[model samples]
Target chain A: AQTVTQSQPEMSVQEAETVTLSCTYDTSENNYYLFWYKQPPSRQMILVIRQEAYKQQNATENRFSVNFQKAAKSFSLKISDSQLGDTAMYFCALSGGSYIPTFGRGTSLIVHP
Target chain B: GAGVSQSPSNKVTEKGKDVELRCDPISGHTALYWYRQSLGQGLEFLIYFQGNSAPDKSGLPSDRFSAERTGGSVSTLTIQRTQQEDSAVYLCASSIPKGLAALPSYNEQFFGPGTRLTVL
Candidate 1:
C-alpha cells in the first residue's frame, strides 16, 4: 500500500510572495503519478499540477509547479506570486495504474494581503 | 457535454438510516471513482470502477458501504445503517480509460459537486 504524507498542517503566505507545501509518499511501484489538488471554501476539488514519475522534468502550470524527486519519494508544490484566490486546502495524492488513490492529510494555505 | 454531477448536494439522516448518493460522470468516461472527505481531512478512497468491473475493492471502509456502476455510466454509492463516522462529503470523479493505443494519465480527474452527508 502507498501512503502520502504532508508535513505542514497549515501555511500562510503574503500576497505576491511564494509558498511551498511539502509532501512525501511511500510507494513500491515505480510507475506512478503525483498530483496537487486545491479545495476552496466552495469545496470544489481543483487540480493544481501533476508530475509523471517517468518525467524527470518538473511540471509547471503558470503559478503552480511541483518538485518531484522520485528517488527521495518526495513531491512538493510551489505557488508563486500567491494571490488571495490561492487560499484553500491543498492535498497531495499518488496513484499507479487504475488503482485507488492515496491522499495525504492535506495542508491549509492562507494567502493574506 | 457536461462535467460530472452529483445529486442531493446535502443529505442529513439519522443513525441506522440508509442513504444513496448518485453520480453522473462525464460523457464517454469509462472510469469513475468514489471518495469521502471528512472535515479538515484528506480524501479517503472508497471505490473505483472501470467500465463495469471493479478491479479494486480494498478501499471500502466496511461491508455496509457498497457501490455499483450501471450502463458504463452512472454510479451509486449506498451506505446501510449509516454511522456518524460516515458523515462526510462524498466526491465522484471520472476519467477516460486507456484504450488499445491511447494511454490514460493518472491526474486530470473531473470531479462533481460532492454530496455532503451528515449522519446524526
Candidate 2:
C-alpha cells in the first residue's frame, strides 16, 4: 500500500513571498506519479503540479514547482510569489500504475495581504 | 469544455437512511472515481470505474457503500444504513485513460465540486 504524508496542517505566507509545503510517501512501486492538488473555498480540487518518479528533473508549472527526491521518497511543493488567490487546502497524492491515488491529509495555506 | 459535475451539492440524511450521490463525468472520459473527504479521514478513494466496469473497489470503507457507472458516463454512489460516521464530502473525478500498456502516462483527473453528505 502507498501512503502520502503532509506534515504541515496549516501554513501562512505573506503576499509576494514564497512558501514550501512538504510531502513524503511510502511506496514499493518503482515507477509512479506524485501530485499536488489545491482545493479552494469553492471546494473545487485543482491540479497544481505533477512529477514522474522516473524523471530525475523536478516538475514546474509557472509559480508551482515540485522538489522530488526519489531516494528520499520526498516530493515537496513550492509556491513562488504567493498571491491571495493561492490560499487553499493543498493535498499531496501518490499513484502508481493502478491510477488510483492515495491522498494525504491536506495542508491549509493562507496568503496574507 | 465543462469539467466533471455532481448533483445535489448537499445532502442531509438521518441515521439508518439510505443516500445516493450522483456524478456526471466529462464526456469521452473512460475512467471515473469516487472519494470521501472528512476531517478525520482526509481524502480516501472509495471506488474506481473504467468504462462502466469497476476493476478496483477496495477503497470502499464498508459494505454499506457501493457505486456504479452507467453508459460509461454517469456514476452513482449509494450508502445504505448510513451512520453518523458517514458524514463527509463525496467527491467525483474523471480522466482519460491511456492504453493498458501506458498506464504510467494516464491523463490528469478532472474533479467536480463535491457533494457534502451529512448523516445525522
Candidate 3:
C-alpha cells in the first residue's frame, strides 16, 4: 500500500510572495504519479500540478511548480507570486497504473494582503 | 453541464436511517469514482465504476455501503443503517480510459462540488 505524508499542516504567505508545502510518500512501485490538489472555501478539489515518477524534470503549471525527488520520495509544491485565491487547503496524493489514489492529510495555505 | 455534477449538495440524516448520494459524470467519460473526505482527513476511495462492468467496490468500508451505476451514466451511493461515523463529504470524479493525458495527464480530475453529509 502507498501512503502520502504532508508534514506542514499550515502555511501563510503574503500576496505576490512565494510559499512551499512539503510532501513525502512511501511506495515500492517504480511507475507512479504524484499530485497536489487545492480545496478553496468552496470545498471543491482542484488539481494544482502532477509529476510522473519517470520524469526527471519537475512539473510546473504557471504559478505552481513541484520539486520531485524520486529517491528521497519527496514531492513538494511551490506557489510563486501567490494570490489571495491561493488560500486553500492543499492535499498531496499518490497513484500508479491503478486509478485509486492515496492522499495526504493536507496543508492549509493562507495568502494575506 | 461541462463539469461533473452531484445531487443534493448537502444531506443530513439521523443515525440508522438510509441515505443516497448521486453523481452525474461528464459526457463520454468511461470511468467514474467515489471518495469520502472525513472532516480534517484526506480522501478515502469508496468505489469505482469503469464502463458497463460491475464496479470495483473494494474500498467500501462496510456491508452497509453499496453503489450502482445506471445505463453507464449516473451513479448512486447508498448507505444502509447509516452511523454517525458515516458523516463526511462525498466527492465524485470522472475521466477517460487512457487516463489524464487526454486530460492532458496533469493527472487532473474533474471533481464535483461534493455532497456534505452529516449524520446525527
Candidate 4:
C-alpha cells in the first residue's frame, strides 16, 4: 500500500511571490506516479503537475513545478508568481503498481493579492 | 470534448436515506475512479473501474458504500443508510487505459466538478 503525507495544513503567500508545499510518500513499488491537484472554491479539481518515478528530471507546467526527490520519497510543489486565483486546496498523490492513487490530507493555500 | 461530468451537484438527504451519485467519464477512456473528500481533508479513494475487468473495491469504506459502472462509461455510487459522516464531496475522474502504452500521459486523470452530499 502507498501512503501520502502533506505536513502543512495551511499556507499563505502574497501575489507575485513563490510558495512551496511539501509532500512525502512511502511505497514499496519501484515504479509509480506522483501528482499535484488544485481544488478551487468551485469544487473543481485541476491537475497541476505530475512526475513519474522512473524519470530523473522534475516536472513543470507553466507557473507550477515539482521537485521530486526519489531517494528521499519527497515531492514538493512550487508555485511561482502566485496569484489570488491560485488560492485553493492542494493535494499530493501517488499511484503505484495497483494503479490507484493514494492522496494526502490537503494543504489549503491562500494567495493574497 | 467533454471532461468527466457528475450530476446532482448537491444532494441533501436524511440520515437513513439512500443517495445515488452519477458520473459520466470522457469518451474512450477505459479507467474511472471514485473518491471522497470530507471538509478540510484530502481525497479518499472509494473505488476504481477499468474496462470489463472486476473493479478494485479495497478502498470502499464499508459495504454501504457501493458503486457500479455500466457500459464502461457511466458510473453510479450508492450509499445505503447514509450517515452524517457520509456527507462530503464525491469526485469522479477518468483516464486512458493504464497499460495502453508506456507513456506517463496515459495515467493522467481528468476529473469532474464533483457532487457535494450532505446527510442530515
Whose lDDT is greatest here?
4
Q: Model 2: runs farther than 4 Å from truth? A: B104-106
lDDT of 4 by residue, A23-103 (tens): 999999888889998989886788888898999999999999999999999999999999999999999988887667788
Least accurate 10 contiguous residues by lDDT in model 4 chain B: B97-106
Return the candidate ranking by DockQ, descending.
2, 1, 4, 3
Candidate 1, residues B2-73, lDDT tens digits: the string is 989998899999999999999999888888889898987888878888876654567899999998888989
lDDT of 3 at B52: 82
In candidate 2, residue B118 scores what lDDT? Answer: 92
Model 1: residues with Cα > 4 Å off, grouped in runs = B99-105
lDDT of each residue in B79-100, candidate 2, tens digit only? 9999999999999998886765
Error of 3 at B68 (Å): 0.5
What's the C-alpha lDDT at position B3 in model 2?
Answer: 86
| Candidate 3 chain A worst ten-residue window by lDDT | A93-102
Candidate 3 Cα deviation (angstroms), residue B88 = 0.8
* Collision count for each candidate, in order: 0, 0, 4, 0
DockQ for all models, in order?
0.58, 0.63, 0.54, 0.57
True contacts kept of each: 0.59, 0.61, 0.52, 0.59
lDDT of 3 by residue, B63-89 (tens): 999999998889999999999999999
- The deviation in Å at residue A68 for candidate 3 is 0.8
lDDT (0-100) at residue B101 of candidate 4?
51
- Residues B1-120 of candidate 4 have per-residue lDDT tens digits of 488899999999999999999999998988899999898778888998988989989889999999999999999999999999999999999888546554322377889999999999
- Of 1 and 2, which scores higher on DockQ? 2
Candidate 3 lDDT over A1-113, as tens digits, reads 88999989889999999999999999888788898999998777888888989999999999999999998999999999999999999999888657677899999999999
